[model samples]
Target chain A: MIQFTNISKSFDEVKAVRNVSLSIDEGQLFGFIGPDGAGKTTLFRMLNSLLIADEGSIELFGLDPHKDYKKVRQIIGYMPGKFSLYYDLSIEENLNFFATVFGTTIEENYHLIEDIYKQIEPFKKRHAGKLSGGMKQKLALCCALIHKPKLLLLDEPTTGVDAVSRREFWDMLKSLKSKGITIVVSTPYMDEAGMCDSVALMQNGQIHAVESPKAIVDNFQKELLAVKCNDMYKALLTLRNYENCYNVYPFGEYLHYIDKRDSKPIEDINDCLLKHDLQEIEINPVKPDIEDCFIELTRKLSV
Target chain B: MENEQVIIVRDLVKKFGDFTANAGLNFHVDKGEIFGFLGANGAGKTTAMRILCGLSSPTSGLVEVAGYNVKTHAEEVKKRIGYMSQKFSLFEDLTIWENMRFFSTVYGMNKTAFKERGEMLLRKLELFEKRNRLVSTLSLGWKQKLAFTVAILHEPSIVFLDEPTGGVDPITRRQFWEMIYEAADNGITVFVTTHYMDEAEYCNRVTIMVDGRIDALDTPAKLKEKYQVNSMNDVFLALAR
Candidate 1:
């Protein structure tokens, strides 16, 4: 449905988005996961024709985003990360305005956003600024979808809302995809990465990994262990100072340790703990999460 | 008493006219726990956070943060709490050091103490080299890290980070979490609200808020298992469904 060939964008000397080429299929929820300033927004803006790429080709449904922006805009729904709706307008008014922009009426596209709209309908008369962050988000989603574009580009939709709201918003997106709307979303949330059909893990204006979340996790080439001890702080100190420790860092309640290239497996970890006289020892292989993979990838890049 | 929580709010309520943003909310955070406050849009997380940080007044309900009542002793709460807002909460035009100093002064830290703390915090975030640089000049991730540092510069007993990692890189997000651990190790209670479920996994415990109400609150593992989902996002979806 979408194709980009050697898309490279720059703002003066800084290359906000490096030459990137990838193809996205139709009826798919594609996740672009990266930190701020990694050019996620820049790339999205380019796709929507809000900004022109310095060097590259963007084909949306086989039409150029730059040349066919008007036709492209009609087929795409964009929910910006920043609250872009008129803050003074009521929720209904924003929806109506956006619907009118695409030469449609709220009555016409009301069914598309009805699920999300009903949640905020009680506050329909309230000013957007008066709504909570989560409410504003839903309203934005409703307004964006009012036109019912074939492609939806949401920039960090769950960035500021609460956990439940974040969950609810994704639910709405999944429902949208069920209606066969091809969705593209950019988020910094690693947990959200696994929900998508495919994801492109990006860093420093470059893609670190791009594949299904499961495939990426399944491709982990290193053995991982979760180690808990009497003094986790001391254990971390001991582990980081250990001779064969590859990556030793605390993860929530336990410290996650990966052995060096040539280090032994479970026995070696147990032996190290026994030698340190650490109590309540628990050394077991564990699956690495997207965050773990992300941290590992970033560390590799830094090195 | 030693196991007692640092923040305890019962029936926490906030209203804007007839609208009740937070109604009858009850939650607490352990002395040094990284508590995740999850909620959808309009779920009252921000309102509750505002009251906790002394930024806004709760219309009703008993609210306690770091042992301070939100209503009667907001100043005391402010003195002991640090806050990072959802947006560009820092001064866009000011230098990083200036912004930190200004926040220090607002928090009533004296010159000597502010100087020592400011330098230390800046160094911890590796922003010392960019201390004199304008806030606008720094990348979004760098600015957020600096903001998180400034929030805790007073060494407050509790810190509230409201979507502090939004729009930043994954590496920076990991680094931000690292700083949170360092703070927790130093005995500072972290109260945060983020849309990232993976981040929710980092919290000692997480509470899910939907439509101004808490739907689920527990360890990420329990929540994931209960929902029969592999990720926090799915856990949230399962509960919401």
Candidate 2:
């Protein structure tokens, strides 16, 4: 449904996007996973015709965004990373305004956003600026869906949102995807990559890898180990200094450790930590996750 | 060093007109401890944090930070404590060295101390080569690390970080935590607020807020066991939902 061929964009001297080529099938939920300045926003803008790419081309629903800007805008809904809505207007008014701008009415697209809009219906009279972060996010989603566009583009929808609200927002996206709408979203959070049908790991304006979340994790070449001890900071330092240590970083309650070799080398890791006077050492082999894969990919790129 | 309470909040309540942002909060953060403040978007985390930082006054109850009552000793509290948010704490237009000099001067550091610590920090962060570069030219990760170093440049007893890792890459996020760990080891109490549940596990103690009250307060391990969940995210979802 969407395709980009050798797309590249530069702002002044910095290359915001570097020859990125990607495609999203119809009715698929695709995610661009990267941190700020990773070109997710630039690529989105290029797709929506807000910014023209310095090289290559973009096609949405087989229509070139540069040439057919008006038609492309009509068929695609774009929600920016920063909340972009009529803050001075009430929640209901913002929705109505967006609908009218898209040549539709609230009554016409009510079913498309009913599940999400109903939650904020009681406060429809309240100004958008007065709403909290979660409420504003919901209202933004409602506004984005009011026109029933064929494709939805959300840039970093869960960036500053809390964990609970982030999960709810993902669920809302999933429901929208279930309705056969092609959705493309971006986020800095690696864990959210798992929720997408496929995710493009982006960094420094380049796409390093794109695959299903499970496939990405399975493709991790390292034999990962989770190590826990009484003093995690000391243990991390000790493990990083180990002879066979490839990479060791803190992950939640434990430190994710990788050895230079393909083997687990659990006893050697435990011995290294124990020799450093670390106590309560526990080492277990653990499967790599999307965050681990992303880190590994970035490391490979830098190397 | 072992059990000294750096921050003490008892029945802390903050109200905005008729809205109660914080309702009867009672907690204490020990010296050299990493305390995690977590909650939903409107769970009053910011209000409670502001009161502790002496940025905002509490409507009722006592709130002490850095061995001073926030209400009467707001200036004293501000002098002894540092604050940094994800939005940034450094001047974008100034070069890295200039930003450091400005903040150290604002914190009233001696010339000798600022010069000594400033060079040490720049070298440690590997930003010494780019010291003359403008802060606006640095990447988000670099900016956050620089902001963090400058926040603790004054050597405050406690530092308040409001979501310091927001929108940062995975590698830099861990690196930032390493800096926090180093600060705590140096006897600087760290009070951080974050939305990443995995980060909550790194805290020595975490307090989860709900609506306008303290819903759960305990160590990550204890909270996990209490909620019968394996991860802090599940515990947070259980309480906040």
lDDT of 2 at A23: 90
- Can you give the lDDT of residue A57 in candidate 2? 85
lDDT of 2 by residue, B76-188 (tens): 99999888988759899999999999999999999999999999989999999999999989999999999999999999999999888878788998899899988988899
In CAPRI terms, model 2 is classed as medium
Each prediction's RMSD to truth: 3.9, 1.5
Each model's total of backbone clashes = 14, 0
Residues A1-303 of candidate 2 have per-residue lDDT tens digits of 789999999989999999999898999999999989999999999999999999998889989999999999998888988789888999989999999899999999899999999999999999999998889999999888899999999999887788998989999999999999999999998888989999999999999998998899989988999998888888888888888989999887788999999765998887888889999889999999887888889899899
TM-score of each: 0.83, 0.97
Pairs of residues at least 3 apart in sequence or in different chains that clash in candidate 2: none
| TM-score, cand. 1 vs. native | 0.83
Please compute the TM-score of chain B alone for each predicted structure, in the order given: 0.93, 0.97
How big is the positional error of residue A215 in model 1, measured in Å on the Cα after superposition?
A: 2.3
lDDT of each: 0.83, 0.91
